[model samples]
Target: MKSSMHNPHLAPEKYGIMDGISECIVTTISSKGPNAAPMGIIKNSNGIKIRVFKGSKTYGNIMNFPFLAANVVYDPKIYTMTTFSNLERSQFDTIVYEDVEFPVLKDGISWMLFECNNLQKSSQSLVADLIPVKAKLSHIDAVRAPNRGFNSVLEACIHATRYQLTGSQKYLDLMQYHAEIIRKCGGKTEKEALDQLYRFMKTNK
Candidate 1:
């Protein structure tokens, strides 16, 4: 285990990834094309770790090519969009490393390129140790207070993803619970994001 402070090639703290779980969007490329999904990563002295369920585009893409880019994003709309719908080509920017083109979010504030190592698989999930090989900061951090409405929207997006995958009513129930908070505290973006999520859920169901 190596501390990120001593690592020359990668530093987790620079990307606002601390000791606990940091939520971000992970993008991976396959023969078909790029895939994006909201993911939570844990950063420790051991490095970054991620888990993805089987039968997902992210899971299959990483299995074929073990390289991915994790993008730090603050926008709730992006979370909702990626969790339910496929991102258009225009939403991505490309960076080539050793002839492999990795898709990055144009709206990402910062991103880290990782090579998935120490692959571990189970019946339900694939867990990988992410080794940060490259990183970039796309925008300067703006000064803004914390918004619970925005955070609630992200939480709802997670529940929505779970509901989509498992077709469970409990997840849908949880999403509706968060919808209350979004209506009460969220701004225009959060409200719009929630609406889009509900629309997707309606059509998918």
Candidate 2:
């Protein structure tokens, strides 16, 4: 599907996103209202694919409604909240398309509305084929440059989540390595995010 909004910065190919995982906050509306989660999006020539596990609120909502929004954000709090807890309704705003509900993160840099065409379900998860319907670039300038500190924080967050799930010492070691990088090379925001991750790990451990 073609997007109505034109965003030069949405050129995934230029950012080397042709085939890799791009982290984003995915929001969907359920009967209970809106829910958000951190998701790693797989982008390729075919389209964007999202793997939503069965029994998850995201999977259930998309299965019922077949529409969701993917919001690109750089906020560490957004990542932590969505991954560890549900977001409050006030944290997001809504955009209505053809009466279809789309939840947009207030702090997101960009957002894309996706309509699920096919759902291939496996024993572990449901892979949804997403067709982009609407997209907007809110902070084009922000994403124009590369920041190692920010990237490290995102990578560390992924490892931290994995460690939480599996309690693997390997992931914990990796998380600590990334934390060191954040301490040495990260900026204020990166350091702040690292602190949050450390606090979470201490409590969770």
Q: What TM-score against the true fold does each predicted structure earn?
A: 0.91, 0.84
lDDT, candidate 2, 1-205, per-residue tens: 2234333445654333347787888999877899998887899776778998776789898888887788888776677667667888888988877665578887788788777767898998999877666667777677436667777787888888788889899998888888788888877878887888778778777
Cα misplacement distance, residue 111 of candidate 1 (Å):
0.7
Q: Which 10-residue span in candidate 2 carries the lowest summed lDDT? A: 1-10
lDDT of each: 0.85, 0.77
In model 2, the runs with Cα more than 4 Å from the true position are 1-19
lDDT of 1 by residue, 1-205 (tens): 1212224757777876678888889999988888899888887777689998898899999888888888988788888888887799889999977666789998888888888887899999999988787788877664458888998998898898789889999998899889999999999999999999999888887
Every candidate's CA RMSD: 3.4, 3.9
Clash pairs of candidate 1?
none
* Top of the candidates by TM-score: 1
Estimate the TM-score for candidate 1.
Answer: 0.91
